[model samples]
Target: MLRKGLILAAFGLAFVAGPAFASAGPKEPRQASWSFEGPFGKFDQAQVQRGYKVYREVCAACHSMSLLSFRNLGQKSGPFYDDKYPNPNDNPYVKSIAKDYQVNDIDSETGDVVQRTATSADTFPSPFANEAAARASNGGALPPDLSVMIKARPQGAQYVYSILTGYQAPPAGLEVPPNQYYNPYMPGDVSAFYKGKGHVPVGGFIAMAPPLEADKVTFDDGTKSTLDQQAKDVVAFLAWASEPKQTERKQFGVAAMIYLLIFAGLLWVSYRRIWRNVAH
Candidate 1:
């Protein structure tokens, strides 16, 4: 009877402590619906185009998308893809886009390296020459290459959207460190590092300042340039960049499932027919 009482008490204690423990971690990112979320979902082309604009006008200064080539902008699955530019290499718009940046190339006659207008074959260039330069520019925090950022994070697009919109002044009793801005969604907090130094509250901070603001970029489609709207558009574009073939893959999966279901039904019918004349 004593053992039973001890076990019951232990369980009661666990039941009481579970909620407290569960709430200890960083706040879970709020989930946002995506146009390309489910099996039947397809990306909204206009949103993707708007997202590309936001990336180009705002985020491009700090982030490099080295994995993507200029021609990728005209890909069939990409936001800027169009029937007119079936061959992205020869697309006039793609060529014009590439020309916006200067690329280093060796001169055919002189064999000397020279900066020239980029072509569709060229990948997007990094803003800084190297990691040292990047770190020097940003006060020791190296800006991450954004090519696969959405895939690299825990919640991908949702987490990014939260981070973009989550910046806030530290609460009344909390002390934020210099050069570090308060953002609850980012990992690591002032409290964790400042044990006994002061009354620093628990919430992560980031080095990159808030990049988005209202009316930062004029949308061609006339969509309101609210912070949330810009964040959503950019996240959608990043999602596409991470998995351009998502729609095709989902379509194939649906087709495969349908075929398997039909095949299974036929097999079951055949087995019953074949065993009809025999005893189990």
Candidate 2:
């Protein structure tokens, strides 16, 4: 009884402190509901495709998705995947998309490196030749790759969506440094109250300007391309990119849970039967 009481006391204290600990972090990120959120959640294919369009037309100019390949885009789990094109390698649409980019390759006959039309097997190429060129073009700030961006950031998809839509005029009396844009969502300088305290700013002065705007990309599905809509869609796509197997993982988890419950029940029944003839 004493041990149980101590455990209950500890739990009570934890319950009381939970909100305090949660509030200690930097401002709470704006929450956005995603189709692929809960256990039974699934990706909205149309939104994913629209988001991909946004990434290709706008975000691709500065950011690189180095870890993704054209073939991955047509996998069964991908938004663009179609039963009609089961094999991404032979998919006509994938082939057409790959042909737009120039990839570096070794010449077959010349024995030298040359730029060739990209194939479905080729990974998405970087916009600039190297990091130096990328920095030079973007005023010394390196644009992060979007391959695992959803997984990389805290609060994942919601944080990204907030950052994309959070750009605004700095609050009164805050001096935003040159070349530094003000965004409440980006981990930047702290408020005046915590100036000299031990709290150091985590994220500040983002280099890339606001990338999304109203009607920035035309959606083939006829959805109005508002700023928030674009942010939501692209973040959804990034979430899928980061964890393509999320749905499968959840499905497996459900099965495992059911199995464990059944096993536990059987064990309990066997224990009761075996001890039925004996005394405690």
Please, what are the lDDT tens digits per residue for candidate 2 over residues 1-280? Answer: 9999999999998877554333233345798889898988888888889888999999999999988898877876677888898897888777888899998899899999899999999999999999999999998889999999999988989889988988887554455666768666776444432233333333345788999999989999899999999999999889988887777788899899999999999999999999999988
| lDDT computed for candidate 2 | 0.82
Model 2 TM-score relative to the real fold: 0.80
lDDT tens digits, residue span 235-269, model 1:
99888887777777888999999999999999999
Candidate-wise lDDT, in order: 0.84, 0.82
Per-model TM values vs. the true structure: 0.83, 0.80
Flag clash pairs in model 2.
Answer: 187-203, 188-203
lDDT of 1: 0.84
Question: What shift in Å separates residue 166 of candidate 2 from its native position after superposition?
Answer: 0.3
- Identify the leading candidate in terms of lDDT: 1
- Name the runs in model 1 displaced over 4 angstroms: 1-25, 108-112, 192-202, 273-275
- Candidate 2: lDDT of 209? 90
Q: Choose the strongest candidate by TM-score.
A: 1
